[model samples]
Target: MNNQQWTGWSSGAQQAEQHYLVEPRYLAGGGNLHHVADFLRASGWSDKSKTGGPLVFDSPDKSVRIGYDPYTQPGGWTISANPADGQEAWHATFTRQTPVEIVAGFTDALTRPRSAHAPNAWGPLQEQRWQTEQGQHFTAMSPDGGAWLQYHQSQPGQALWWAGARNEHGRIWDASFTASTPMHLIESFSAALADPQQVMRPRGHVPPSTRIRTTSVSVRPDELSAWQQARVTAARAATWARASWATTRPRHTTATGPHTQAGGRTRR
Candidate 1:
C-alpha cells in the first residue's frame, strides 16, 4: 500500500524513510470533538499528554499523538519513529503500523447510522493551503454546497480541522499534503460529509440542496475600520474568483497566495 523508495537518503535531496502515507478526509462531525475522541479511545490510545492535544498511543517503541496535531509538528502530523523521548522501537512499532489506521478507523465511524445522521452528502470540493502570521492552514469547501472546513498543519504529521467556529466548537481531523492522493480523498469526503444545515444528518445521510451559494460571513461593524472593510470585501471577491477557478482547475493547487478567511472562521 505504501510505495517508499530510498533514492536519496544522504544526497541532500529527499529523505528516505518507511511510512504509510495517510489519506485525509472531510468527515461528518455531528458530535464534535467528543466524537473524534471516542475513536481514539476505541483504538486503544490515551490522551495523557499535558500539552492539550489529541489522544496518543505511547509504547516502548514509539510516541505519536493518535490523531494529527499541527501545533507541535508543522507541515504534517507528529509521527516520529525515533522520538526524542527515548523510545527505542520507534521504527519497529511504526514500521508494522501506519497512521492510515487511525484515519481509516475514524472515517469508518463516520459511516455509521447515528454519526453522520443521513447518507453521505458532503466532501472537499477544493482546498487552498497557505501560510499566515499565525500558521499554515487550509480552506476547504463542499462541492455539493454546504459549509466551509478550515484546518491547519500544526506539526509534521498532525493537523487540526475546524469551521469558522473552529475553536468555537469541537475539532475535526483534516490534513494531508496539498498534492498527495489523500488530498483527493479529502476533497471527496468534504463534499460527502459536510452538513450545511448545521444539523446532524439522519441515518448519516446529508440532505440534498440546490441552494449552492458561497458560504456567508458575519462581521460585527466595530470589528474593522472603513478601510479594512473595503480591503476585506476585495479579498472576499478574490477568494470567490479563486474558488471558481478551482472548479475547473486541478484538484490540488499549490498557491502561496494570501488567505481571505477573516479570523480563520468558516461560515455554515
Candidate 2:
C-alpha cells in the first residue's frame, strides 16, 4: 500500500505489514494496532533497525522512518518511527514488565545458574524488574497513554526496561528504566499512583464516577414474628428505677423512717 494511503489498512493488514516490515508494535491507539503496524512496516521500520530510513507516501509532505535499539543488561526492544513531513509522527516501544511473580520465578531460576556469579549477577535482571514496575505505574497515569507517553519521555535512542506486577487490587503495574538511575522510574510510579488513568483520558475529558447501593427486605410472617419477639425481649430486658432509698427498702418503709443497722441497732 502507498505510504500516504497506508492509514486505511485494518488491524489484520497492520499485523501482516509488521510481519513483512519486521517492526515491533508499541503504543497503539484508536483501536488500530494493526493499521498502524502496517503503516510502519510499509515504511521499512522494524525492531532490528538501528537507524530509520526514508520512505515515500501518497502525500508529498509526508515522510517516515523507523529505528530500534537494545537496552542494557536486561535485553529489551526500543522502536521509534516518525512521519516527519506529515502533520505528525507516530512512535512506540515494546518492553516486558517483569511481573513480581515473574521476578520471583527468575530469581528461583537463577538459584542454580551454571556460573557462581550467575546468582549474584542478577543486577541486570533486577534492574529490568525495577524498570517494569516504574513503567507500569508511569503508563497507567501517563497523560497521553502509556506507549506514547513513555516514548516521548524516554531519552532519544534508548530502550526503557521495567518489571511488571499485579497490584493488591489486581491492577497491572510496572517499573521503568532510564539513564543513570531508577529515580525517573520512581517519579513515573508516583505519577501513575496519583493518576492511574492519566494517559487514557479523552482529550480534556474526565471520567465519571460510579456508585452502587444495596438494600434488603424480608416480609415472611415467621421472620416478622421473630423480629417482633426479639424487639419485645429487648424492651423487657431494659428497665429504669428512681434512686430514692424508699424504693430499695421494704414496702413498709417511708421517706422519714429510720433504717436498722448492724446488731439490730436502729439508726436515725
Write down the lDDT of every candidate, Cα atoms only.
0.34, 0.27
On TM-score, the candidate that comes out on top is 1
Evaluated at residue 123, the lDDT of candidate 2 is 34
Each model's Cα RMSD? 24.8, 29.8
- Give the number of colliding residue pairs in candidate 1: 43
Which number leads on lDDT? 1
Candidate 2 per-residue lDDT, tens place, 1-268, comes to 1121222222231222111110011111112122222333332223233334222122111222222222443333232224343323333222333221222222112111133231222233233332322442233222222221232234456454343333223323333434222232233333322222212111122111121111122133343335345533432233112224436765444455587443553543
Q: Where in model 1 is the C-alpha error above 4 Å?
A: 1-31, 46-48, 51-64, 67-176, 181-188, 195-268
- What TM-score would each prediction reach against the true structure? 0.25, 0.18
Ten residues in a row with the worst lDDT in model 2?
19-28
lDDT of 1: 0.34
| Candidate 2 local lDDT, residue 41 | 37
Predicted candidate 2, C-alpha RMSD: 29.8
Tens-digit lDDT string for candidate 1 (56-132): 44422234333444354332233333335332322111111112332333342322213333322122233222111
Candidate 2 accuracy as lDDT? 0.27
